[model samples]
Target: MKIDSLTSVQGQQKLFDNGNARVTKVDGQGEQPQPQQIASTIYHKDDPVLPANYGTYDIKAVINENVEDPETMNARYNRVQELFGFGIAERSVDLELGYLSGVESLSQGLRDKDWGFSIQDGELQVIEGSDSLSDEERSQITDALKGAGVEYAAQSVANAVIEMIETERSPNGLSRSIGRFDVNQSNFADVVDLRSFMEDYQVGGKYGKGIVNPNDIQARYFGAGTGIMDQVAAKADETFLYKGR
Candidate 1:
């Protein structure tokens, strides 16, 4: 009826609809792709070498890392031991001094070895004799008895009294006095041994003219004795007489 439609629209619309409705096919063939299984890899290695024992370990390195130097550590240890030793030694000396001081405080009248209170004339005479002894005589008697080991106890008492007196006047005097006494005692022993050796060996030969041929060794011994006596006198004066004063 109308002019034949210039355009053929009948199949064109169908083709467009078919194309829009079509679904793409997926190929589920050959080994279906597995999710790439990746396991977490953890690598563990051996521990480093270490020292076996505790103290035996390289002390230097340990000290460097943990404490101080080797020398400082050793010195500190030794100093501790020394301090402990000194404390023990000082305590012993103090105890000894205390005992001696107690003995020294006793009266001379009560110091007699015999406990008898008899008033005999012979005992009185003996006491009077001792009272009259000069310093030199007292020293000689003390020395003789000391050599026999019979007067050490008495001398110790006397020394203790002297120490107390010195300590009362000067706080540290007793310690100093003890140190000096030890040194002098050693010196005295050495001198005596030296003299004895010289005498026995006859180090020096005879000298002088025919009639006046004198043994140089004997002369030397006399001189040495005189010198030693002088030194002894000086030391005694310094130690006993002037210490407290």
Candidate 2:
């Protein structure tokens, strides 16, 4: 962690002739260190959406869909793929991206600005692209950060942004990936449509349970008709493929 002050020793120096190696304070005798509470929210796709439109929630935008900018879309695609399961698929996608403009660094990858580090949150954080920033460059950034209503650069805002990003990763929700403003849960869920082989095979959902709502696609193989299950699946595949097509 970067700090304002730091000191390191090159060699050992002793001020006292003797030292004591004993426990001075018992556990909980002095002020206790409290765990930092993450003041952010999380939810599942199927869970209730409370605090609806409450505060300035993050709106996730999928590349090619919402984030249509060529450079930015391509630049931020790595985050989408790393956080979300798939990258930009031909299939439709609408997601609420966390940290679209917060907690930025000199990304070795794509940058939002032409040159230098840029964070497009409430305040524009611009770090000049130079090995050693000049006095003018430093003043420019400091003044920019001190602008009115520049809440995005604040630590609280940055924390909230991280919370939302973590939500969309593996432990993400269907609604979260589709929300205008939402967060992902701490788990993962995937699906597959059956127009190919093994149509009758079951795919379990979270916690190894059958999908809460089954028979949702193709009417469970176009109505599992009265016949051997395997035969029904085979016929359904053929029907959906040759007949429907």
Candidate 3:
């Protein structure tokens, strides 16, 4: 849904008061209409349909008054990093799927099912059954990836095939990958490179790696690091997370 559809109090109220009425007899008949009973009955007349409420509400002015200007805060850096974390998580997933499955439209696949990118309760979750790849059985994933092209795609598929071949692989592989990358400086640098590549090549920015066609890389990795930060902010009950001193 369009963000603009969110509720504002700009429109007229849906409820109405039917004017308190005194009964008037039609031709002085029908038992004087019984004083039209003042029992507060509600009725609808022919009026246009009211717009549905979109659940938007104004922030309290008093709260806004006490907050610092976001533009002026050095702490914004920390907040940015936090957001980057979620983005990284999603990116990792996208990269794994793309490099492994040779599917360039993975993000669109998620979006089509309304499972679009989201940070919920300190985690990045793309609901299962929301994407085309996700709808397939394990055997199908193996077959598709094995036939995919690109060196990275081949390697990724090999890894997946191996994992599926194993009996007791870790169930939290994705989560653990995100957590591990967050604490690993080397991984972070790789992410920076990936992000830069995305910006320069994929997104048509000046600083991209330019080694490969930017469009060949999936869009999911471009801003996934930001997704992590969104989860942090949402979970911390803050709009922005300042690097804690």
Candidate 4:
């Protein structure tokens, strides 16, 4: 029962000396003994959290980014022509069109968007206007033209559109330039419509008497790949034959 009295206290202290064991002090004033605090195991407890090794985004960000910049959007527009092209044709678009500047806003309506008109490096806080194509406008224009499935004539149309918007600033000029592109971006192979040619031979009006839109001739006996350039002069009759619909 009396353990302390039975034990050699000094020899016991030598046996249990693993350093700093927790203990409590008891006072005669009927107060409960309070436990002593222990030192933290980790040395750097106040350090900041470590950063992640890879980029991360939420569902909202994913949706927003996809909508703002599609990976690739298939472009298809109905081809309207009075000549042989009175149907549809396959078209291709640029992949980088989505990432072009100002495409998110300007593609909706180029005429409606306002330009931050500055006279000389933010000097003139004048009236708002959409008279010119800055970098933003240029990007928007290129995106639109390229995304419209323009090929071969893309450079010329883009140049003409950019110049018109930059210099002439006329809405009519802009519209006409766009319409002019419709002519240039044609699927019609610079040839007369077979139906129109037949009609002209019978009882025609406009498409007759060499008043053709393209003026190049197309017939059952004739062939495809006939344009301003045959594109493949040697193989025009072989590779690019028009299977008449």
Candidate 5:
């Protein structure tokens, strides 16, 4: 939150005395007061895709596989997952995997003019990369984003590139650790999959009223029979080995 302007201490004091709306107030007799950053009121009603309180949605209904039309049922289920759950898995992985390194690479690319991107007045712009982009490459990027229904695809590309670059320059402490753990120590996909399954279990227990079992949903989704279930149970048991110890 950066303040855009400054005010006099006397003016701030007078404002306080008059009970006027307060911004940042400087101390001392002659000091100038810098205005505090105000929170932005602007928000996009449609951009987030899911509701803020998405947890309240009827999970069982959303994941229904028992509908008469298999194609319709699959489509409906897929749509729900895309809108609310697993569809973002790959993107989430991309955003997490080698995050720091990818960012560094992107920054280096930008600096070397190998990738085309720029920031001016806090806004990202996609310019020509160092080696000029082929028309085919440019068209491919634009077309793919357009196909995905992204508005302002060029700007989004620029922003994403900039974010990746900036992220490499200064990634969060926890993210750096997590990225390392995922890359060097553990199977990231297994972790994400297991977490998703466990989350479904909790969601079912909370709202299914004995009707929805997360394992049942997993079985259906993965075409897993009893043998697979047994193996899954074993995996789960192994994962929770220290739970009751």
Candidate 6:
């Protein structure tokens, strides 16, 4: 049967007039019929479609407007401290004490799996761990510190080793004498035995006298004082006793 000769031809034309029909055109080169482009549908007020709305907002601007400036923030903080009868104990860090700084670095170095140093009995030493530093590694670190304008670089490196050994926290959260020093991204040419270096010197364990290290004494007092203040503030006229550790 021919398509045009069908009885549904009139019904199909009526469907097309009502926008319910798809039209196609046959290609001239014996290709399949292709769909004709259709005009977009215009939605009316009665159409069942949800409306979409979009907008942009500046959150940073809102935050900045409400935030207080640095000076004002500091003033408010100080005022609060005064109201609580709290006085902050400040300690000046003397970078010139390169030995102390080195010990601090030692703490950091051991934490970072780097070279470790220590200071005991008025002497400073570096630990020779299982993975000892090579000559090339030592030279690289020395060069880096020198290039970085680190004064007393040698002393600092040695102290870092001491800090790791003396205050190196154990797995169980206690201090230990023997600990490994590991450095990453550094190569040393030769490894020295720390034990041999301290063979002539004796290791001091117990501090019979009062706190020797000024820094350590300051820290103990500062910590104890802070706790006292806290307790005094909370108890309000109640006495609290704290013995130095």
Ranking by TM-score: 3, 5, 2, 6, 1, 4
Q: For residues 123-222, write the lDDT of model 2, one tens digit per residue.
A: 3343443355657654544453344223332323223333434333322223322222222121110011111111221233121124333322221211
Which candidate wins on TM-score?
3
Q: Could you say which candidate leads in lDDT?
A: 3
Clash count in backbone of candidate 1: 0
Estimate the TM-score of every prediction.
0.17, 0.20, 0.22, 0.16, 0.20, 0.18
| Candidate 3 residue spans exceeding 4 A from truth | 1-127, 130-138, 142-223, 231-245
Model 2 off-target regions past 4 Å? 1-126, 130-132, 151-157, 169-245
Any idea what lDDT model 4 has? 0.22
- The worst-scoring run of ten residues by lDDT in candidate 3 lies at 54-63
After TM-score superposition, the amount by which residue 115's alpha carbon in candidate 4 deviates from its true location, in angstroms, is 14
Q: What TM-score does candidate 6 reach? A: 0.18
lDDT of 6 at 175: 19
RMSD after CA superposition, every candidate: 49.5, 28.2, 23.8, 39.5, 25.5, 36.5
Give one digit per residue, the lDDT tens place, for model 6 in 27-98: 334334233322112112222221231011111100121343333423432332221111111110111123
Cα shift from native, residue 158, model 2 (Å): 3.3
Q: Which of the two, 1 or 5, has more TM-score? A: 5
- The stretch of ten residues in a row with the least summed lDDT in candidate 2 is 88-97
How many clashes does the backbone of model 4 have? 0
Q: Report the C-alpha displacement of residue 15, candidate 2, in angstroms.
A: 66
Tens digits of per-residue lDDT for model 4, 6-104: 111111111111122222333334334243322101111122111131111111111122222221110100111111111010100111122122233
Question: Over 4 Å off in model 1, which ranges?
Answer: 1-66, 103-245
Q: Give the winner by TM-score: 3 or 6.
A: 3
